[model samples]
Target: MMRVGIDIGGTKTQAVALADSGEIAASVTLPTMRGEDAVLATTTSSVVALAATAGRELGEFSSIGIGIPGHVDRVGGRVRNAVNLGVRSLELGPALRERFGIPVEIDNDVTAAAAGAAHLMSLSGTVAFLNLGTGLAAGIVVDGVAWRGQAGAAGEIGHLPVDPHGLECPCGQRGCLETIASGAGLRRAWPAGGAHPGRGLVRAMESGDADARRAFEGLVSGAAGCVRILALSIDPQTIVIGGGLSRLGEPLRQALGATLREWSGTSPFIADLKLPERVQFLPENTPAAAVGAALVSRT
Candidate 1:
């Protein structure tokens, strides 16, 4: 049976249809609509359109899976505190299941992405997907299965308060890791009037600007801290980095590696683990979460 997966991101929503063999039959991306109802409507329509594009009726697909931001209550089929999508609280799984007339599975976007990455890489054992996007989070997969913790909030490393006196996060916490490690956090470090804040900051850093370098270093440190926590806590075979900041590509990895080396030089345990070597980056076009969403329905 065919499976459909939808990723509801902060700015864009993507839908993909996968055949029984795990090949993508069709996919579509649309700007995420504003407001609660519109967002739900857009997601539903996107899935339907993707199925039509594959020349298959909705009934042909056996199940649907969706990945959305913020806290999710899987059993209740409700989403809470999805600030980026502007959805405070919404009942998504039940609504979509009713509309599509199929079984639906909804999960945190980062978790879904982690599952997708594991599936695509054919990874086994423990693997952690650290998503550094508009927000920060990690998704853990054990033995090829996603682990959401008891409260379905397992990988919320973004809220792992790093600094007691740091910037306030939307989650009503001060100095959460997200404030220092995420794309949103990076932008906050830029000048108020800087054009193309992210690129501009990178350019400034490349030009030997002291302040820029400091900002960049902070990002590297935040990222390294995340890796350390994951390594010491889960010791995953691989820690895959994804999301918007992952676009920083090799540079991000290099900086992270440097920090890990610094720590490893001081601590024999860190040196033994070689956490830097375990880190990997996804290809720019691999929609692991969306793909994982499809995989979820089948599982």
Candidate 2:
């Protein structure tokens, strides 16, 4: 049976209907509204749209899965503290299941992305997905299964304090890795770049904006640090980069490689890990979280 997956984000929500063979047979995208009721309405509409796109009834799909940000109670299908989406707490799973009369599953967005990346990229063994979006986090997939850790905090590397003297994070930590590498971090550092700092970063740097250059350098270093931490801790076979900052694309990849190489030059152990070779970007335009949510439904 085809599976339906929904990815809810701060700006937009995307849903996809996946065929039995794992290909997306139908999809829909819509602006995501804020608050519990609106969010639920948006999700419901997306699923309805997907069903219409595929010319099938809602009950025809085998399952419906969701990938959402913030703290997720996977078993309970609830979301909490999803600040960007204006969601404080929501019973996402039960609401959807009741609406469609199909099984519903909820997963962390990054975790869902990990599953999608592994399947879409045809990766095996342990794979780490590092999300460098408005914030930084990671998701781990072993074989085809997600490793959410004992308390479902497995990939919260963004909150790890890297600098005690650095800026305070929303998580009540100072100098967290996310404060240096994420889109929020860039906005905090380079306020002149306006709302979306990453979009104008390269141009500002090209025009010799010292602040932009510094922000970019910090982003690269922080991202490299995340990679190093993932390599040393998880020892994954591959590290897939995703999120908003990754849109910097080739320049970001090359800079990350250069940073890793520089670290390797300083430490023999780092060189032995061959981190630069293990890093890769998520394929452009792939709705990893949405596809992953679909995959998660069966599990």
Candidate 3:
């Protein structure tokens, strides 16, 4: 049986139908609507539309899954603190299950993406997916299963305190990794404020702007810190980096490699682990979260 997966983000919602053979049979993207009710309505409609687009009926789907941007109570099928979605508390899973009369699963978007990465990469053993999107987070998968931790906060690496005197984070903390390493962090750290500060900073740095170079250096250092933390803690088989900043591509990986080299030279343990070589990039068009949601429906 095919499965329906939905990835709900702040700006847009994506739906995909995964055939029994693990192929994407159909997919659709739509602007995310505002308000709790509208968002729920849109999600249901989008999944049905994807199924139809795949030339299949809703009854053909065995399960439905959704990746939401918030703290999810997997046991209770509820979500909270999803500020971008303008939802404080939502019983999304039960609502969708009732609407479609099928089993439904809900999880953090990044966690779902990690599952997708593991599937896409065909990785085994332990793997960590470092998401450098608007926020920073890491998703851990062990032997093909997502490890959500004791409280579903397992992969919240962004909130890890990295600096004692760094900028304050929306999570009511200072020096969180997100403030230094994420795309949003890079934009906020830019010396010149603008509509697209991160891109502007990168451009300026490429054009030989000293200040932009310094800013990027700091951002690169933060990213390295994230990798080091993941490496020392989980020692996963590989680290898959994805998200919006992934567009930076080689430049980003080069920065990460340089930092890892510096640390490896200073510490024998770092050199022995060879963490830099384990880092890899996700494909440009991979719908990690949506595909992951479909994969998780069975679990």
lDDT: which candidate is best?
2
lDDT of 2 at 243: 92
Number of clashes recorded per candidate: 1, 0, 0
Q: Which of the two candidates, 1 or 3, achieves a greater TM-score against the reference?
A: 3
Q: Name the regions of candidate 2 deviating beyond 4 angstroms.
A: none
For each candidate, what is the lDDT? 0.84, 0.92, 0.84
Candidate 2 local lDDT, 1-299, one digit each (tens): 79998999989999999999999999999999999999999999999989899999877898998999988888889999999899999999999888888899999999999999998999999999999999899999999799999888887899988888999998888999999999999998899988889899999998999999989999999999999999988899999999988999888888899999999999999999999999989988889999999998788
lDDT of 3 by residue, 1-299 (tens): 78888889888899988888888889998889877887888898898788779888889988988888878877677888788888888888899889889999998888888888898788888888898888899988887788888877876888988889988998999999888887677767675736545667667888887766776786788778888888888888988998877777778889889899999999998899898889888988788889888888778
- State in Å the error of residue 288, model 3: 0.6
lDDT of 2 at 132: 93
Candidates sorted by TM-score, descending order? 2, 3, 1
List the candidate 1 regions with Cα displacement exceeding 4 Å: 164-174, 193-196
Better of 2 and 3 by TM-score: 2
Please report, as a residue range, the 10-residue window in candidate 3 with the lowest summed lDDT. Answer: 191-200
Residue range 1-299, candidate 1, lDDT tens digits: 68998899888899998888878889999899767898899998898798779998888988888898877886777888888788988899899988989988888888889989988887888889999887788999887688888887787888888888889987898988888887778777755415334556666778887766766777788889999989888889999998887887777778889899999999998899988889988878887988988886556
